[model samples]
Target: MPPSPSTRSQAAAPPRRDRGDACPGALRLHQAADGHLARIRLPAGDLTVRQATALADAADLLGDGHLSLTSRGNAELRGLAEDCGARLATLLRDAGLLPSERHERIRNILASPLAGLDRHTPSDVRRWARELDALLCASESATALSGRFLFVLDDGRGDVAALGGDVSLLAESAGDGAGPAGSALLRVGDDPAALRIAGPDAPRAALTAAEAFLTAAAASGSGAWRVRELPDGHGLTARDVAGALRSAGIEAAYVAEPPAPATRTSPPYADSAAPGIVEGPDGDRALSVLAPLGRLTVAQWRLLTAIADADGSGALRLTPWRGIVLPGLPAATAPDRLAELSAAGLITDPASPWHRLGACTGRPGCAKSRTDVRADATAAVATGTTVPAEAPTGSPPSGVPVSPVGVPVSPAGVPVYWSGCERRCGHPHGTWVDVLATAEGYRVALVDPDTAPTAAPAPARTAAPPAP
Candidate 1:
């Protein structure tokens, strides 16, 4: 018998979705302004040497000669030919990148990129992610999940647990060499509370919770694509999820406001690990690098794949921060390999201007953008004009706090998002500077800076960012 769910109603229902999610997938290409865009889901951002080469080849032969990295650790190919869908699908399928066509779009998973590689991490959430992915593809019921549905696997290091996951499995501390057999917390949506269960059972528990969401969303008839979209007074709670898990014979201990990792990061996909070498506790080493502006050419992509194949492990770990980690590297040859990566235009230094900056595909790629935000942002960074992170297209918010002259950034690299318009599509959460592209130039504002602001707001300026 199935247990009843304890629904928690919100004060306000989320905006209703009348249409199906059009989020692009590998087979289902999206027609962008540049051309067809295909988003390839890499579960936990795990990529093999062969798979990486396939992508690079696809980008060069079919689409533009570039690969774009997403905040979910996935890769995107833009400027693709309108009729290249069949060839693209076949390439990915042969590489085993597309396992189940039916379940391809629903395989949105994010995990700690440094899982099993860093000393601070006690468990390898990557194993859990692989398990969950398999469960998703096998379950016919999971096919009903929206393409936008996301699952986050966070190791005890607290790297990727809070990037707005629909179903988040946070690995609890299991001491040294606990592996993946430790206990974990299963958090649904953004609820501060969680339900604890065995680590080995974490994957199953995640699937169960997601299934519960489907049931709730169906009952609500809200056409919600994500758990957070459930209407007010019709939401699922920790109690509801626990009831579902227990029905499956999985034990779930409830924790009111589960304790978060002490070293947690805010949203907008900040890179917790700097670009360079990461040493595991066992004396193993990995070479880390970042893509400038979250876009990579096939040349750069192949270079990374070659470096990984030669010096590091044959696998590439794509971080949620839009970075890559080449793990299991030979210690003696890592420095030379890293030098090669740096020379090839990859961001290898933490202090590099490209480290904390991100921008959407504005200008020619996106028809909605007012201007080329990326070019302006690059210019801003070059001139030391303090750049912020991503923003979307829409009207600017009134009564916003205005930023003072100059884009001041923290030493730890607070990200600045640049958008062609006001949608603020992928902007970083928490406090950040808002640099909106106005017809005159860029309108700079201090969004959610401090408790509030005083005095009159600064006027928008038309001057181009001065050179450094």
Candidate 2:
């Protein structure tokens, strides 16, 4: 079984702060192993067609022309030149991408990628997301939060909640008008559901809750940034959070264990059989596009923008899984547009090569990686050795079948990930087979499905003879 929320919350050891977190941003780039890395924050993972194209252009102009999607629903440009940081910042700013330099890193918010469309969801979570973002940017103290600090506004589903955010506001039924017209359960970590606030006030309540955590961190003087890192006795409590909300003139009621909600995964984009039937106001139909291995080229980015302009609504939604959802497109034009994307090697089918596969910025992008893992994995796939379903089952004990080079493919479509080293930065969220690169070649194992394992040990690639 997956670890209880409390157990998961306690897993992170108190972070030892040597200095402030220097996580790269569009304005502040990081000198990565491959080159300079710039991370552009996408609040609520909303991207305009033009903005998406701009990111692709930035990648091609300043970096290696490859874009990487982060777990936080942001984008990363690797292999950037040290000198291009300023120019890149200017380009992003002109595109209305970087609104605040001070609040850039603190804009970590993940909401239901399909909140507005899902019948079960409340009104668009985007509104609350935008409001919370504006509030966070305006607060001077929010700068103190670490770049990794996260906030999730789930549409009552446990999807984003499963990500283990620092602050989470889950929408819930208003309980027959007991409190207000629309209210949600406010929770922290795996703790008992602590409060209930008006649905409209959820954003403010979330911010207040964050402030309470910051206040506790300040009192602890541990220099801790995340809520989980607070010492046992110094942790923030529901009562204290309620007090803080009251002080801010927000009504909040304490509740016990709150009900866990369901979360939505990336809907399959390959199903474009009836496109124009579900049309949007602009006479465009929804087009779901996937980025193979979650990486896209500048040319491909431009092509997507053109497709969206010609065939879809002007807006784009970037899923946490690194896929794009173009809503409001004309149903008649969707099939052809999807074919264009597929011809360009984008994953348009659920059974395509990109489905369960993910890779980090290996080779030239990350200095810590021992091998160009992505290249090697691609080669393995091209040779027809790595079958999509061959990924192993529950954490295969050490010395299990390694790669497509020798292992027989399984019938079930299990997930697999290729990691440069043990860090395994971009491993898939749920059940997956782990293939880690070693001095020898690649170590393979079936990871335990119930518990989300961080990284599994891979045998040295040198252990086995090279495949002929």
Per lDDT, the best of the predicted structures is 1
For candidate 1, what is the lDDT?
0.76
| Reference-based TM-score of each model | 0.86, 0.83
Name the lDDT value of residue 384 in candidate 2: 44
Which digits, one per residue and each the tens of the lDDT, describe model 2 over residues 1-468? 123564454354565444566566778777887788888889888888878878877887889988877766778888899999888988898888878889898798988765654344554567889899989888887878877677877776566665557787777655433345467767775465568888888888888888888889888877666776677778877777889889999988887755555433334111111111233444445666668667888777778788767666677777666777776666677788888878887777765555656676677666778989778767665654433444445334333323457331221345567777776775654456677777986766666434544354332222111000
Per-residue accuracy of model 1 over 309-370 as CA lDDT, tens digit each: 98777999887677899999877888898899999999999878777676778889877779
Worst 10-residue lDDT window, candidate 2 = 459-468
Q: Which stretches of candidate 1 lie over 4 Å from their true place?
A: 1-13, 175-181, 264-270, 385-412, 446-468
Among all windows of 10 consecutive residues in model 1, the one with the lowest summed lDDT is 459-468
Best by the TM-score measure: 1
User: For model 1, what is the error of residue 242's alpha carbon versus the real structure, in angstroms, after optimal superposition?
Assistant: 0.6
For each of the candidates, give the backbone clash count: 19, 22
Whole-model lDDT for model 2 versus the true structure?
0.68
